[model samples]
Target: MASSPFLNEVRTSIRVRGMSIRTEKTYIYWIRFFIRYNHCRHPTEMGAAEVVDFLGHLATERNVAVNTQRIALNALAYLYNQFLKQPLGDLES
Candidate 1:
């Protein structure tokens, strides 16, 4: 499948910041997962509630380790705070 323009924009943002290739890939993967998890909704249409739900799902349903959950959170944090310029301030997860 073709990549979404939004993901491309993310790659551009990552590169501009001199982030490592692995970090770029990881962030993209998690962002894509987040989008898909929310039924492909645009990130701008969602906020902290969705983020909290997703992370909770990771911890409870998926049984992911704390570090894994933290990584996902970091990815989403960057997606909002840096890329979208809509900070999800103090998400409760």
Candidate 2:
């Protein structure tokens, strides 16, 4: 079996866990943005620092709405906890 990429694994797991289609789409969207923002760097090579910067950019630079920002956070949380199977520890404000 082909091992899934981090993003794909996140999507599958989220769907399997019964997240709504809208939630899944939002999560996947942010995850894709995270990858592209980092120049398509694989999620395996990224850590919380990248996530923090991305989230900050979403909230401050892009001026995303609060719910949109929360979606980004949830996407990264799924990437760390489910896809990468790594503990993300505490997020810095």
Candidate 3:
């Protein structure tokens, strides 16, 4: 898969701002899964349905704990809010 430009931007900003490595890793993981959940489509082209699908996969398919799922969601939300500057209020399940 091609490296996502959006993910690159997010990583760059996080590194430049001196974010913790854990935070950077978590954000990248979420963004990568988000992309795959939408069939490798760009996040800019995805909507609440895609987000919901990804979260559902985490909860049901992956059997992640509630807190873990929430953390992933928060990571993705940060990417949406900070990197893309896209409003995520409408994406809430």
Task: Assess each prediction's global lDDT (C-alpha) against the native.
Answer: 0.95, 0.83, 0.80
lDDT of 1 at 83: 93
Can you write out model 2's per-residue Cα lDDT over 2-88, one digit (the tens) per residue? Answer: 333766767788989999989887888888889999999888798888998998898889999998888789888987887778867
Candidate 3 runs further than 4 Å off: 1-3, 90-93
Candidate 3 lDDT over 4-89, as tens digits, reads: 67788888988987989998988888888878777788888875677778889999999999998888888878777777788577
Over 4 Å off, model 1: none
Cα deviation of 82 in candidate 1 (Å)?
0.5
> What stretches of model 2 exceed 4 Å from their correct place?
1-6
Model 3 C-alpha RMSD to native: 2.2
lDDT of 1 by residue, 1-93 (tens): 578998999999999999999999999999999999999999999999999999999999999999999999999999999999999998865
Record all residue pairs in model 3 with backbone atoms less than 3 Å apart, i.e. clashing: none
Order of all candidates by TM-score, from best down to worst?
Answer: 1, 2, 3
Each prediction's total of clashing residue pairs, residues at least 3 apart in sequence or on different chains, is 0, 0, 0
Best by lDDT: 1
Q: What TM-score would candidate 3 get against the native?
A: 0.83
